[model samples]
Target: MSEQLKQQFTKRIVELQKRIDSIHHDFANGRHADWSEQAGERENDEVLNALESEAKIEIQQLSNAILRIDNDTYGYCGTCGEAINEQRLAVQPSATKCIKCAD
Candidate 1:
């Protein structure tokens, strides 16, 4: 990877880490439980929990992407070894495939 791209990825990884930490803290404090008791609230809580779980999984993927960045493999598609497009990377820094391979 180019030094500039690596730097950008590192910066992004740091930002993601901060966000993930904040989410963890919020969840630990039961902040989302505030909505667990309104009308139709059980379903809302289920959806929110599912979304939060997905976010946590994505955060782990982002952390893995940071490792790949450090290892100089950040922009390579995991499925086919093609170079992942910069635009795609900008949209999803944790992506492991090129658009074609992803499709």
Candidate 2:
């Protein structure tokens, strides 16, 4: 990858790391307690829990993307070993497959 693109990806990865850290901190500190309490209905709690779990999973994916960037593998399709499109990377930094391979 070009140095400029690598720098850009590094910056984005750092931003994602920060967001993941914030989410973890909030969850650890019980920041979502109010939401859990205000759920009022069992269904609401269930929905909220599911959403939180999804967010955690996404954060882990972002973290893995950052690791890929550090390892100089970021922008390469894991399935086909092809360069991932810059546009697609901009839209989904954690993506691990090229368009064709993804499809």
Candidate 3:
């Protein structure tokens, strides 16, 4: 089960990295000549920047979860030291805290 979770995390990490690379590509090489159109593009770029930041953070969290799995502490809550609920883990395998402590 832990191995399965590790594989799942690994897959998500790859997906996020791809998305980040695509975002960087967009940022580096595309723009309209007209100032007005460029302003609109800048707005879209800001949203992409936020998404890129979010993906980076999630990647780090998933990386941490992988470490926990290796250490045999994958299912335990980081804050309360309780076994994380199965349902919660199903929905969020990289979670570091149980529902109680998370709340």
Candidate 4:
């Protein structure tokens, strides 16, 4: 189970890293000749920035989860030091809190 969870976390991290790289590539190559198109791209910048930020934060959370798994502490809640539900972990592999602590 630990190996499986570690693989899952690693897979998710790869996916998020790809998304972040794609976002960075888009930002780097943003170019529009038309004024209206430039304005539209600028408008899209805000959305892209928000998305990039969200992806980064999720990546950090997943990385921390991986660390916990490595330290033999992955299934425990960070807040209450109780075992997190297996169902919850199945649903949210990156979860760091048990239901009681979450509430």
User: In what order do the candidates fall by lDDT, top score first?
Assistant: 3, 4, 1, 2
Per-residue CA lDDT of model 1 for 63-101, tens digit only, reads 688778778888899999999999998898788999999
Instruction: Kindly report which residue stretches of model 4 are placed more than 4 angstroms away from their true locations once superposed.
Output: none
lDDT preference between candidates 1 and 2, better one: 1
What is the RMSD of candidate 2? 5.1
lDDT, candidate 4, 1-103, per-residue tens: 7788778888988998899899899999967999999999998888889988988888898888889988999989999999999999888878999999888
lDDT of 3 at 77: 95
Total backbone collisions for each predicted model:
0, 0, 0, 0
For model 3 the local lDDT of residue 29 reads 86
Among these predictions, the greatest lDDT belongs to 3
Candidate 4 least-lDDT 10 residues: 1-10
Question: Each candidate's root-mean-square deviation in Å?
Answer: 4.3, 5.1, 1.0, 1.3
lDDT: worst 10-residue window of model 3: 89-98
Candidate 4 structure lDDT? 0.88
For model 1, the superposed segments whose C-alpha errors exceed 4 Å read 1-39
TM-score of each: 0.62, 0.62, 0.93, 0.89
